[model samples]
Target: MNYCVVGTNNMTASQGFYNALFAQAGLQTVLPSERMTYWIGDDFAFATAEPFDKKPATHGNGTMVGFSVGSKEEVKKLHGLALRLGGRCEGAPHQRGPKFSAYVRDLDDNKLCFSD
Candidate 1:
C-alpha cells in the first residue's frame, strides 16, 4: 500500500511515540502539520492524526496495520519499543506460519504487526 494511518486523540503523545519508533525503524518524517504527522520509507507512508470530524479518535475493530521490518531481531526490537512507549502487547514475537511476527496496540489502541 502507498500509505496507512491511525487515529489519535493526543497528537503530542502519539507524535513522540511514533517519532522514536520510526526513527529506529528508519522511516523519515515528512510534511508534519498540526493535525497529522507522517513518516515515509521507500514507497510506503504511515501516519497518525487527530480525527477530521472533531470527535475523539478510536481504533477500529479488527483493523490492523502490518509492517515488514526485515528480520526477527528487528521485529522483537520494535515490539519491545512499542510497549516501552505505552503500547500494549497483543502478541509476542513468534513464528506465525511462514513469517515471524509480533503484535502491539498503540497508545491509541491501533493494532500494528511487525514481521520478518
Candidate 2:
C-alpha cells in the first residue's frame, strides 16, 4: 500500500518552519500554490496544512518521523543545519550500529530522525 503523512497546524508560522526544515534536509517542497507545503522524498512525503477547525497538538511524548540519507556525512550536515535553523538536537550525530544517525525536533516539536 502507498501512504503519505501530513501534519496539520493552526498557524502559517508552523508550516514555514517546516519549509526551512525540509530545505535543510535537501528535500523539495511541493505546494499546489502558496497555501500548503509538502516535502517530497523518494518513498514518502510530509505535508502541512493550516488548521481550520482544529487546534494544534501539544508538544512532546516521543512521536517521530524519520528519513534516511546516503552517508554519515550527510546525516551530520543535515543535523547541523537543523540546529542552525532552530531545531533542537534530541541526540547528537553518532553511529547507532553500522550506520550513523541522529535526531532533532523541529520548532513545532515534531521529532525527525536522520540516518545513513
Q: lDDT scores for all predictions?
A: 0.93, 0.71
TM-score of 2: 0.75
Q: For candidate 1, write residues 1-116 as lDDT tens digits.
A: 67999999998899899998888667888756799989988888999989899899999999999999999999999999999999999999999999999999999999999999
Query: Least accurate stretch of 10 residues (summed lDDT) in model 1?
Result: 24-33
CA RMSD of each candidate after superposition: 1.0, 3.0
How many Å off is the CA of 102 in candidate 1? Answer: 0.4
State TM-scores per candidate.
0.95, 0.75
Where does candidate 1 clash, by residue pair?
A: none
Residue pairs clashing in model 2 are none
Distance (Å) between predicted and true CA of 110, model 2? 0.5
lDDT of 2: 0.71
